[model samples]
Target: MNLHKILIFSSCLFLLPYLNIVLFIEETTSNFYEKYMSMLLVCNFIFSVLFWHNPISKSIIHKIDGFFAKLSVVTVFLYVAFIKDVDPYNENIFFLLYLFFISFARLSNKHSRKEWCSNSHIFYHFLMHLSGIFGGIVAFL
Candidate 1:
Protein backbone atom coordinates (compact mmCIF):
# COMPACT_ATOMS: atom_id res chain seq x y z
CA MET A 1 0.00 0.00 0.00
CA ASN A 2 1.05 3.58 -0.66
CA LEU A 3 1.30 6.20 2.05
CA HIS A 4 -2.20 7.49 1.41
CA LYS A 5 -3.81 4.09 1.62
CA ILE A 6 -1.71 3.25 4.63
CA LEU A 7 -2.88 6.35 6.45
CA ILE A 8 -6.50 5.62 5.67
CA PHE A 9 -6.17 2.02 6.71
CA SER A 10 -4.48 3.00 9.93
CA SER A 11 -7.18 5.51 10.71
CA CYS A 12 -9.91 2.97 10.18
CA LEU A 13 -8.13 0.43 12.32
CA PHE A 14 -7.62 3.04 15.02
CA LEU A 15 -11.22 4.14 15.06
CA LEU A 16 -12.92 0.77 15.06
CA PRO A 17 -11.90 -0.23 18.54
CA TYR A 18 -13.20 2.99 20.00
CA LEU A 19 -16.38 2.57 18.02
CA ASN A 20 -16.70 -0.90 19.44
CA ILE A 21 -16.37 0.50 22.91
CA VAL A 22 -18.94 3.22 22.36
CA LEU A 23 -21.41 1.02 20.56
CA PHE A 24 -21.22 -1.72 23.13
CA ILE A 25 -20.79 0.26 26.31
CA GLU A 26 -23.61 -1.48 28.10
CA GLU A 27 -22.38 -4.92 27.30
CA THR A 28 -18.92 -4.18 28.67
CA THR A 29 -19.95 -4.27 32.25
CA SER A 30 -16.63 -5.61 33.35
CA ASN A 31 -14.73 -2.43 33.99
CA PHE A 32 -11.30 -4.02 34.24
CA TYR A 33 -11.42 -5.88 30.96
CA GLU A 34 -13.01 -3.00 29.14
CA LYS A 35 -10.37 -0.58 30.30
CA TYR A 36 -7.55 -2.98 29.55
CA MET A 37 -8.80 -3.72 26.07
CA SER A 38 -9.38 -0.07 25.32
CA MET A 39 -5.85 0.76 26.45
CA LEU A 40 -4.38 -1.92 24.26
CA LEU A 41 -6.34 -0.74 21.26
CA VAL A 42 -5.26 2.81 21.83
CA CYS A 43 -1.64 1.77 22.13
CA ASN A 44 -1.92 -0.21 18.93
CA PHE A 45 -3.29 2.84 17.15
CA ILE A 46 -0.49 4.98 18.46
CA PHE A 47 2.06 2.41 17.40
CA SER A 48 0.67 2.31 13.89
CA VAL A 49 0.75 6.07 13.53
CA LEU A 50 4.24 6.40 14.90
CA PHE A 51 5.63 3.58 12.84
CA TRP A 52 4.10 4.88 9.66
CA HIS A 53 5.11 8.46 10.23
CA ASN A 54 8.67 7.83 11.32
CA PRO A 55 11.50 8.43 8.87
CA ILE A 56 12.51 4.84 8.44
CA SER A 57 12.67 2.29 5.66
CA LYS A 58 9.26 1.21 4.41
CA SER A 59 10.21 -2.44 4.69
CA ILE A 60 11.23 -1.99 8.30
CA ILE A 61 8.05 -0.12 9.07
CA HIS A 62 5.97 -2.84 7.51
CA LYS A 63 7.80 -5.51 9.46
CA ILE A 64 7.35 -3.69 12.77
CA ASP A 65 3.70 -2.94 12.09
CA GLY A 66 2.98 -6.53 11.12
CA PHE A 67 4.64 -7.82 14.24
CA PHE A 68 2.75 -5.44 16.49
CA ALA A 69 -0.51 -6.18 14.73
CA LYS A 70 -0.10 -9.87 15.37
CA LEU A 71 0.86 -9.15 18.94
CA SER A 72 -2.28 -7.08 19.32
CA VAL A 73 -4.38 -9.92 18.00
CA VAL A 74 -2.84 -12.39 20.40
CA THR A 75 -3.25 -9.94 23.26
CA VAL A 76 -6.89 -9.43 22.41
CA PHE A 77 -7.53 -13.14 22.11
CA LEU A 78 -5.92 -13.86 25.44
CA TYR A 79 -7.77 -11.01 27.07
CA VAL A 80 -11.12 -12.21 25.82
CA ALA A 81 -10.32 -15.79 26.67
CA PHE A 82 -9.45 -15.09 30.28
CA ILE A 83 -12.10 -12.51 30.94
CA LYS A 84 -15.34 -13.32 32.70
CA ASP A 85 -18.81 -13.00 31.15
CA VAL A 86 -17.40 -13.20 27.62
CA ASP A 87 -19.20 -16.13 26.09
CA PRO A 88 -17.30 -17.85 23.32
CA TYR A 89 -19.39 -18.08 20.16
CA ASN A 90 -19.11 -18.48 16.44
CA GLU A 91 -18.74 -14.75 15.94
CA ASN A 92 -15.71 -14.60 18.18
CA ILE A 93 -14.19 -17.50 16.34
CA PHE A 94 -14.96 -15.86 13.02
CA PHE A 95 -13.44 -12.61 14.19
CA LEU A 96 -10.15 -14.32 15.02
CA LEU A 97 -10.17 -16.19 11.74
CA TYR A 98 -10.86 -13.03 9.80
CA LEU A 99 -8.05 -11.26 11.64
CA PHE A 100 -5.67 -14.08 10.82
CA PHE A 101 -6.71 -13.99 7.17
CA ILE A 102 -6.17 -10.26 7.01
CA SER A 103 -2.70 -10.64 8.45
CA PHE A 104 -1.85 -13.40 6.02
CA ALA A 105 -3.14 -11.47 3.06
CA ARG A 106 -1.13 -8.44 4.05
CA LEU A 107 2.05 -10.47 4.39
CA SER A 108 1.45 -12.22 1.09
CA ASN A 109 0.75 -8.98 -0.81
CA LYS A 110 4.21 -7.51 -0.41
CA HIS A 111 4.66 -7.18 -4.17
CA SER A 112 1.03 -6.75 -5.21
CA ARG A 113 -0.05 -3.97 -7.55
CA LYS A 114 -3.01 -1.79 -6.64
CA GLU A 115 -5.68 -3.60 -8.60
CA TRP A 116 -8.98 -3.51 -6.80
CA CYS A 117 -10.32 -6.84 -7.98
CA SER A 118 -7.13 -8.86 -8.00
CA ASN A 119 -5.25 -7.15 -5.21
CA SER A 120 -5.40 -9.26 -2.09
CA HIS A 121 -4.20 -6.32 0.01
CA ILE A 122 -7.15 -4.17 -0.87
CA PHE A 123 -9.49 -7.09 -0.41
CA TYR A 124 -7.92 -7.80 2.95
CA HIS A 125 -8.46 -4.24 4.05
CA PHE A 126 -12.10 -4.41 2.99
CA LEU A 127 -12.45 -7.58 4.97
CA MET A 128 -10.79 -5.86 7.92
CA HIS A 129 -13.50 -3.25 8.00
CA LEU A 130 -16.22 -5.86 7.78
CA SER A 131 -14.61 -7.93 10.52
CA GLY A 132 -14.29 -4.87 12.71
CA ILE A 133 -17.99 -4.20 12.39
CA PHE A 134 -18.81 -7.83 12.94
CA GLY A 135 -16.60 -7.95 16.00
CA GLY A 136 -18.29 -4.86 17.37
CA ILE A 137 -21.65 -6.52 17.03
CA VAL A 138 -20.31 -9.62 18.67
CA ALA A 139 -19.02 -7.50 21.53
CA PHE A 140 -22.58 -6.65 22.41
CA LEU A 141 -23.58 -10.26 22.71
Candidate 2:
Protein backbone atom coordinates (compact mmCIF):
# COMPACT_ATOMS: atom_id res chain seq x y z
CA MET A 1 0.00 0.00 0.00
CA ASN A 2 1.02 3.59 -0.48
CA LEU A 3 2.36 5.43 2.54
CA HIS A 4 -0.53 7.87 2.57
CA LYS A 5 -3.06 5.05 2.47
CA ILE A 6 -1.20 3.21 5.19
CA LEU A 7 -1.15 6.28 7.39
CA ILE A 8 -4.85 6.97 6.97
CA PHE A 9 -5.78 3.32 7.50
CA SER A 10 -3.71 3.07 10.65
CA SER A 11 -5.16 6.31 11.96
CA CYS A 12 -8.67 4.99 11.42
CA LEU A 13 -7.77 1.78 13.22
CA PHE A 14 -6.40 3.80 16.11
CA LEU A 15 -9.63 5.77 16.43
CA LEU A 16 -11.98 2.79 16.50
CA PRO A 17 -11.25 1.75 20.07
CA TYR A 18 -11.33 5.32 21.26
CA LEU A 19 -14.65 5.89 19.56
CA ASN A 20 -16.14 2.83 21.23
CA ILE A 21 -14.85 3.83 24.62
CA VAL A 22 -16.24 7.32 24.29
CA LEU A 23 -19.59 6.31 22.85
CA PHE A 24 -20.27 3.39 25.18
CA ILE A 25 -18.47 4.39 28.34
CA GLU A 26 -21.39 3.43 30.58
CA GLU A 27 -21.96 0.07 28.92
CA THR A 28 -18.25 -0.67 28.99
CA THR A 29 -18.26 -0.32 32.74
CA SER A 30 -21.35 -2.39 33.38
CA ASN A 31 -21.04 -5.15 30.79
CA PHE A 32 -18.34 -7.77 31.11
CA TYR A 33 -18.29 -8.51 27.40
CA GLU A 34 -18.07 -4.85 26.55
CA LYS A 35 -15.13 -4.44 28.85
CA TYR A 36 -13.24 -7.28 27.25
CA MET A 37 -14.33 -6.06 23.84
CA SER A 38 -12.80 -2.69 24.59
CA MET A 39 -9.54 -4.36 25.54
CA LEU A 40 -9.57 -6.34 22.32
CA LEU A 41 -10.19 -3.20 20.34
CA VAL A 42 -7.28 -1.47 22.00
CA CYS A 43 -5.01 -4.42 21.35
CA ASN A 44 -6.20 -4.52 17.77
CA PHE A 45 -5.36 -0.87 17.30
CA ILE A 46 -1.93 -1.25 18.81
CA PHE A 47 -0.99 -4.35 16.87
CA SER A 48 -2.33 -2.94 13.62
CA VAL A 49 -0.21 0.18 13.96
CA LEU A 50 2.82 -1.84 14.88
CA PHE A 51 2.46 -4.32 12.08
CA TRP A 52 1.89 -1.67 9.50
CA HIS A 53 4.99 0.23 10.55
CA ASN A 54 7.20 -2.78 11.14
CA PRO A 55 10.16 -3.57 8.88
CA ILE A 56 8.53 -6.23 6.81
CA SER A 57 7.73 -6.89 3.20
CA LYS A 58 4.73 -4.95 1.96
CA SER A 59 3.00 -8.14 0.92
CA ILE A 60 3.45 -9.66 4.36
CA ILE A 61 2.26 -6.50 6.00
CA HIS A 62 -0.85 -6.46 3.88
CA LYS A 63 -1.58 -10.10 4.72
CA ILE A 64 -1.15 -9.58 8.43
CA ASP A 65 -3.18 -6.40 8.41
CA GLY A 66 -5.98 -7.97 6.42
CA PHE A 67 -6.15 -10.94 8.78
CA PHE A 68 -6.35 -8.80 11.89
CA ALA A 69 -8.85 -6.42 10.34
CA LYS A 70 -11.16 -9.29 9.44
CA LEU A 71 -10.69 -10.82 12.86
CA SER A 72 -11.60 -7.57 14.57
CA VAL A 73 -14.71 -7.26 12.47
CA VAL A 74 -15.75 -10.80 13.30
CA THR A 75 -15.13 -10.26 16.99
CA VAL A 76 -17.26 -7.13 16.96
CA PHE A 77 -20.01 -8.92 15.06
CA LEU A 78 -20.12 -11.70 17.62
CA TYR A 79 -20.19 -9.26 20.50
CA VAL A 80 -23.04 -7.30 19.01
CA ALA A 81 -25.03 -10.29 17.79
CA PHE A 82 -24.67 -12.81 20.61
CA ILE A 83 -23.39 -10.99 23.68
CA LYS A 84 -25.46 -7.83 23.60
CA ASP A 85 -29.22 -7.77 23.76
CA VAL A 86 -29.54 -4.82 21.43
CA ASP A 87 -31.93 -4.70 18.51
CA PRO A 88 -30.61 -7.07 15.85
CA TYR A 89 -32.33 -5.65 12.81
CA ASN A 90 -30.63 -2.28 12.64
CA GLU A 91 -27.28 -3.49 13.83
CA ASN A 92 -27.19 -6.40 11.43
CA ILE A 93 -28.16 -4.20 8.54
CA PHE A 94 -25.52 -1.66 9.37
CA PHE A 95 -22.92 -4.35 9.81
CA LEU A 96 -23.79 -5.80 6.46
CA LEU A 97 -23.52 -2.40 4.86
CA TYR A 98 -20.16 -1.93 6.49
CA LEU A 99 -18.99 -5.23 5.08
CA PHE A 100 -20.23 -4.28 1.64
CA PHE A 101 -18.35 -1.00 1.70
CA ILE A 102 -15.18 -2.68 2.91
CA SER A 103 -15.38 -5.31 0.22
CA PHE A 104 -15.84 -2.69 -2.44
CA ALA A 105 -12.92 -0.70 -1.11
CA ARG A 106 -10.71 -3.76 -1.25
CA LEU A 107 -11.80 -4.46 -4.77
CA SER A 108 -11.21 -0.91 -5.81
CA ASN A 109 -7.80 -0.91 -4.27
CA LYS A 110 -6.85 -4.07 -6.12
CA HIS A 111 -8.11 -2.75 -9.43
CA SER A 112 -6.37 0.55 -8.95
CA ARG A 113 -3.05 -1.11 -8.39
CA LYS A 114 -3.49 -3.42 -11.36
CA GLU A 115 -4.45 -0.55 -13.60
CA TRP A 116 -1.94 1.93 -12.14
CA CYS A 117 -4.74 4.26 -11.15
CA SER A 118 -3.61 6.31 -8.19
CA ASN A 119 -6.82 8.31 -8.01
CA SER A 120 -8.91 5.18 -7.75
CA HIS A 121 -6.80 3.94 -4.88
CA ILE A 122 -7.25 7.23 -3.05
CA PHE A 123 -10.99 7.07 -3.57
CA TYR A 124 -11.09 3.56 -2.18
CA HIS A 125 -9.00 4.64 0.79
CA PHE A 126 -11.63 7.26 1.54
CA LEU A 127 -14.31 4.61 1.24
CA MET A 128 -12.42 2.45 3.70
CA HIS A 129 -12.40 5.27 6.25
CA LEU A 130 -16.08 5.90 5.63
CA SER A 131 -16.83 2.23 6.26
CA GLY A 132 -14.92 2.34 9.51
CA ILE A 133 -16.90 5.38 10.59
CA PHE A 134 -20.14 3.61 9.78
CA GLY A 135 -19.03 0.65 11.84
CA GLY A 136 -18.25 2.95 14.74
CA ILE A 137 -21.69 4.50 14.46
CA VAL A 138 -23.28 1.10 14.47
CA ALA A 139 -21.41 0.19 17.61
CA PHE A 140 -22.52 3.34 19.37
CA LEU A 141 -26.14 3.10 18.33
Candidate 3:
Protein backbone atom coordinates (compact mmCIF):
# COMPACT_ATOMS: atom_id res chain seq x y z
CA MET A 1 0.00 0.00 0.00
CA ASN A 2 1.24 3.45 -0.86
CA LEU A 3 1.29 5.58 2.24
CA HIS A 4 1.73 8.65 0.12
CA LYS A 5 -1.62 8.02 -1.50
CA ILE A 6 -3.15 7.52 1.92
CA LEU A 7 -1.58 10.76 3.03
CA ILE A 8 -2.80 12.66 0.01
CA PHE A 9 -6.26 11.16 -0.08
CA SER A 10 -6.88 11.51 3.63
CA SER A 11 -5.49 14.99 3.73
CA CYS A 12 -7.76 16.06 0.89
CA LEU A 13 -10.75 14.40 2.50
CA PHE A 14 -9.97 16.08 5.77
CA LEU A 15 -9.77 19.45 4.09
CA LEU A 16 -12.36 19.16 1.33
CA PRO A 17 -15.08 20.88 3.34
CA TYR A 18 -12.72 23.63 4.31
CA LEU A 19 -11.60 24.09 0.74
CA ASN A 20 -15.17 24.67 -0.30
CA ILE A 21 -15.97 26.93 2.61
CA VAL A 22 -12.89 29.03 2.03
CA LEU A 23 -13.08 29.16 -1.75
CA PHE A 24 -16.54 28.77 -3.27
CA ILE A 25 -18.49 30.46 -0.52
CA GLU A 26 -18.63 34.14 -1.23
CA GLU A 27 -18.94 36.19 1.91
CA THR A 28 -18.47 39.56 3.49
CA THR A 29 -18.10 39.79 7.19
CA SER A 30 -16.57 41.97 9.89
CA ASN A 31 -16.22 39.16 12.37
CA PHE A 32 -12.61 38.86 13.40
CA TYR A 33 -13.08 35.31 14.51
CA GLU A 34 -14.46 34.32 11.14
CA LYS A 35 -11.58 35.97 9.36
CA TYR A 36 -9.08 34.32 11.65
CA MET A 37 -10.73 30.94 11.23
CA SER A 38 -10.60 31.32 7.48
CA MET A 39 -6.96 32.16 7.66
CA LEU A 40 -6.22 29.07 9.73
CA LEU A 41 -8.08 26.81 7.33
CA VAL A 42 -6.00 28.27 4.52
CA CYS A 43 -3.01 26.49 5.99
CA ASN A 44 -4.51 23.19 4.89
CA PHE A 45 -4.54 24.35 1.30
CA ILE A 46 -0.95 25.39 1.61
CA PHE A 47 0.03 21.99 2.91
CA SER A 48 -1.84 20.23 0.10
CA VAL A 49 -0.12 22.27 -2.54
CA LEU A 50 3.26 21.83 -0.96
CA PHE A 51 2.86 18.11 -0.50
CA TRP A 52 1.67 17.62 -4.05
CA HIS A 53 4.49 19.73 -5.38
CA ASN A 54 7.18 17.85 -3.52
CA PRO A 55 6.33 14.95 -1.28
CA ILE A 56 9.80 14.52 0.02
CA SER A 57 11.50 14.48 3.40
CA LYS A 58 13.93 17.11 2.17
CA SER A 59 11.10 19.63 1.84
CA ILE A 60 10.39 21.94 4.76
CA ILE A 61 6.78 22.54 3.77
CA HIS A 62 5.29 20.36 6.49
CA LYS A 63 7.13 22.38 9.08
CA ILE A 64 5.43 25.48 7.77
CA ASP A 65 2.11 23.71 7.88
CA GLY A 66 2.80 22.35 11.35
CA PHE A 67 3.80 25.74 12.66
CA PHE A 68 0.61 27.43 11.50
CA ALA A 69 -1.66 24.53 12.38
CA LYS A 70 -0.25 24.41 15.89
CA LEU A 71 -0.25 28.16 16.22
CA SER A 72 -3.92 28.47 15.27
CA VAL A 73 -4.97 26.72 18.48
CA VAL A 74 -3.24 29.39 20.50
CA THR A 75 -4.71 32.21 18.46
CA VAL A 76 -8.20 30.81 18.30
CA PHE A 77 -8.36 30.22 21.99
CA LEU A 78 -6.88 33.59 22.95
CA TYR A 79 -10.04 35.68 22.75
CA VAL A 80 -11.65 33.54 25.39
CA ALA A 81 -9.11 34.61 27.96
CA PHE A 82 -9.89 38.23 27.17
CA ILE A 83 -13.65 37.90 27.66
CA LYS A 84 -14.81 40.12 30.51
CA ASP A 85 -16.72 37.28 32.14
CA VAL A 86 -15.47 33.95 33.37
CA ASP A 87 -13.98 32.17 30.41
CA PRO A 88 -14.23 28.47 29.72
CA TYR A 89 -11.32 28.63 27.35
CA ASN A 90 -8.95 29.72 30.05
CA GLU A 91 -7.80 26.13 30.06
CA ASN A 92 -7.95 25.70 26.29
CA ILE A 93 -4.31 26.42 25.67
CA PHE A 94 -3.26 23.88 28.22
CA PHE A 95 -5.70 21.36 26.79
CA LEU A 96 -4.33 21.84 23.32
CA LEU A 97 -0.80 21.54 24.60
CA TYR A 98 -1.71 18.31 26.27
CA LEU A 99 -3.18 16.97 23.07
CA PHE A 100 -0.11 18.03 21.13
CA PHE A 101 2.10 16.32 23.63
CA ILE A 102 0.09 13.17 23.11
CA SER A 103 0.59 13.40 19.39
CA PHE A 104 4.23 14.26 19.79
CA ALA A 105 4.60 11.12 21.83
CA ARG A 106 4.00 9.14 18.66
CA LEU A 107 7.46 10.19 17.64
CA SER A 108 8.80 7.75 20.23
CA ASN A 109 10.24 5.46 17.60
CA LYS A 110 13.31 7.13 16.17
CA HIS A 111 12.31 6.18 12.64
CA SER A 112 9.16 8.25 12.89
CA ARG A 113 11.00 11.53 12.45
CA LYS A 114 13.30 9.98 9.90
CA GLU A 115 10.38 9.13 7.62
CA TRP A 116 9.09 12.71 7.69
CA CYS A 117 6.07 11.89 5.53
CA SER A 118 5.34 8.65 7.29
CA ASN A 119 1.74 7.54 7.72
CA SER A 120 1.80 7.90 11.49
CA HIS A 121 3.03 11.47 11.21
CA ILE A 122 0.42 12.25 8.59
CA PHE A 123 -2.34 10.69 10.69
CA TYR A 124 -1.35 12.45 13.87
CA HIS A 125 -0.95 15.74 12.03
CA PHE A 126 -4.40 15.65 10.49
CA LEU A 127 -5.81 14.76 13.89
CA MET A 128 -4.26 17.89 15.30
CA HIS A 129 -5.51 19.91 12.37
CA LEU A 130 -8.99 18.49 12.81
CA SER A 131 -8.94 19.14 16.52
CA GLY A 132 -7.85 22.74 16.12
CA ILE A 133 -10.38 23.61 13.44
CA PHE A 134 -13.27 21.78 15.05
CA GLY A 135 -12.43 23.05 18.50
CA GLY A 136 -12.22 26.61 17.25
CA ILE A 137 -15.58 26.41 15.55
CA VAL A 138 -17.22 24.86 18.60
CA ALA A 139 -15.68 27.23 21.11
CA PHE A 140 -15.76 30.45 19.14
CA LEU A 141 -19.19 30.00 17.67
Instruction: Rank by lDDT, highest first.
Output: 2, 1, 3
Alpha-carbon runs more than 4 Å astray in model 3? 9-30, 81-111
Better of 1 and 2 by lDDT: 2
Model 2: lDDT to the true structure: 0.61
Question: Where is model 2 more than 4 Å wrong at Cα?
Answer: 1-10, 13-17, 22-24, 27-30, 47-60, 112-117
Candidate 2 on 54-129: residue-level lDDT in tens?
Answer: 5243566667666766676776677776666668786877678678767866876696567643566556655665
> CA lDDT, every prediction?
0.55, 0.61, 0.53
Q: Write the per-residue lDDT of candidate 3 for residues 1-141, one digit (tens) a residue.
A: 355454455445535435545665556622565556566656755685567456665358857765665565566556444532324563565456446644644552243576665777656655554554445444433
Query: Over all chains combined, what TM-score does candidate 1 have?
Result: 0.56
What's the CA RMSD for each of the models? Answer: 5.0, 4.0, 5.1
TM-score of each: 0.56, 0.63, 0.56
lDDT of 3 at 44: 59
Clashing pairs in 1: none
lDDT per residue for candidate 1 within 1-141, as digits (tens), equals: 343345446434755766667675765364765666666566656666665455244466657666766665665556555654565575466468657656655644552444432456445554554554355335434
How would the candidate models be sorted by TM-score, starting from the highest? 2, 1, 3
